[model samples]
Target: MPKSAVVLLNRPSLEAPPHVEGAAEFELLDVDAPHVRVLDLGVTRGDGVFETISFGAGHPQALAAHLARLAKSARALDLPEPDADAWERAVLAAASAIDPAPEAYVKTVMTRGLEGDGRPTGWAYASAAPDHSRARSEGIRVVLLDRGYRHDVAKTSPWLLAGSKTLSYAVNRAVLREAARRDADDVVFVSSDGYLLEGSTSNLLLRFGDTLVTPGLDQGILAGTTQGDLFAFARSQGLETEYARLETRKLAEADAAWLVSSVRHAAPIRRVDGVDRAVDTDFTAAVNSHLIGRTS
Candidate 1:
């Protein structure tokens, strides 16, 4: 289960796996090929959605919680509900296919099938993404944007382009490009309401003094999987925590901040525009101990 630093998606070398109908039942067509299965949640009228989870190597909780959150996220999206039993079966099947001695990142993506003639073609798919562990420590740089992606989806966005990870990732890509233009590594969006939403691909966090703060989900932010665990770990260790509408000024003043997600884990925020600061603190050690069961 050795994961690649960067997965060659366009260059899928692993063989396609047989149909993955349930969670525990998956089969790779070949060792050198990557099998990406498809499941359709028949929604043609722009109501499509999916979730991604991170089950870190050897640590079962990450994956377990990810699955639990996946079910909840599916419910939140209000699309067709996924069969839990089938999901469980799929997980087992996928894991069985892997060599357990080495574990890689496991991701499950569910999407809404094509909708046409003013409706959707009923279909949904999920895939176990190949593990890419390199992004965790090297860190990701992000650009801050004045505009945010709080759109109404199914919800025609660029017709034939749904933003539910269903299809249209153009905007997401564009945002990244914009970030690149600004000399930043990634992007973090600020709402007109003045609350910090999130990065283009993940959640935002700030460690203020001894307290950790983030924007609440009420602000149209995606509930981050790693963020939840980080906060939980922080609380367990006697650190104060809070979730509320965040302002750009507060983030600029934060002692330390990070953009978190499954793939990147936590990328420290080095500097915010108009606010020059140094990112010399290492919360990674503390966070790693709390997250991965490593003791100092």
Candidate 2:
């Protein structure tokens, strides 16, 4: 079996017409070949939405939540509602086609097709996850950067696509380079008004004694499915959880902090802006253990 797989959906959205008449739901394709068109809006304008779902032992984690968020992001972009059933099947097929591993991810994308084509392009790509053992155990250093948006941007400027998980990730990628230049491994974005937001591709999680707090969803950040699952895990372990509008100082003052996402699971923050912070190795280990052992 190949290390990666790809499944192209014939009809990404039931609300839109199929790519071909009477075609099967999806078709497995060569992972390395060129599949997207040069003029595709997703390529030209970064107009699309996507979800990366991590699977453990062939079981995709947070499948329902990821699909739900995909649809929500589609709605946010005024794109056709993604056919959840079709996507689920595609995700599973792509995942199973690849070589089994302890960790892997399937990225589902729906892009607005050629400018006037109307038909959207959708595909699910699966591959074995990278080794994140170092980050998970040793932790990572992060720097804080200004996001140039207010905490209320989602409400005040919905047109800016604040809370939506769109394909335009130039800024997200740029931040990582900035982090590297600053001698850090990652970053946590702060709103223009000094409110904490989220990471480039992960969610900010701060532990305050026995409580775990994440920035509220209203702050124009993607609702992290992994973070949600972690919250449930925390509750099961008798840890309190909360969603609040956190200020920058709160992160510096937290007992411990991590950047959690589907693929990386949880990476504890060891340093912020050149200041070394204490890492809770015991709790971090427990969190990662639960995440990797998840069957659903």
Candidate 3:
């Protein structure tokens, strides 16, 4: 992944990775009046749709699998999916921009669009943003916070609950930004009910000696793909995987902790507010091994 250089905000141009470059061409969808366009509202508003996929070297999974998942995610939100041709085109665009030898992150967004007044018209468009991959290999620190939308379950779309990756994300983004502001690498969000939900942009997990514990989707987690992979990986390693309600305190008490996602892959928690973060030695390898996936 290319490290994003701090060019002036007003710079004439900027070089971005495949996902980001693919997203820059969001005009293919018409945002004109009454068309009910789907914008990548997740980039700003909390209301939109998005997906993250892993891309390394020149290889990404074949289109069928990736598209099926994308389509499911879209149908879950009842959002319009790109036509097969459009989806393929976007994939190719994103793929073409990928550095064949590089490991990177790809995020795609589709949101409702704007109105004739030029303001957000309640339509949607999609975009992609890819990034440098090495940091996931290093590790990042995250601080936990007690914040999230209560309607995260009931009022939101049924198929979308913590699963659809919608964009109406002001709270999540603000929390993550605050974490960065605190000089922490990322954020972990706890619910008012005292259950550990997820990191700002990742899924939360911990190892309680022999069991791998992650909050259940009933606890309002985002149903992470990486978390699912980790579960399978844990089971294969003879580790027990459990999805139960997790107390935030359990994170600090666990033998090890990780915030999993496509961008971070698997971020090791190095710090926690008012708690010690040094993980138990026995759990380190189990924590790191889950992110080493090579295929679908």
The clash count of every prediction, one per candidate, is: 35, 0, 37
> Per-residue alpha-carbon lDDT of model 2 for 71-181, expressed as tens digits?
999999999999999999999999999999989999999999888888999999999999999999999999999999999999999999998999999999999999999
Task: Write down the lDDT that model 3 would get.
Answer: 0.55
Question: What is each predicted model's overall lDDT from 0 to 1?
Answer: 0.54, 0.96, 0.55
TM for every model, in the order presented, reads 0.69, 0.99, 0.68
Stretches of candidate 2 off by over 4 Å are none
- The C-alpha RMSD in Å for every predicted model, in order, reads 7.5, 0.7, 8.7
Looking at model 1, report the run of 10 residues with the lowest lDDT sum: 5-14
Candidate whose lDDT is highest: 2
Best by TM-score: 2
lDDT of 1 by residue, 187-229 (tens): 8888754557788877888888889999876555666768888
Cand. 3 TM to true fold: 0.68
Candidate 3 lDDT for residue 285: 49
TM-score of model 1 vs. true structure: 0.69
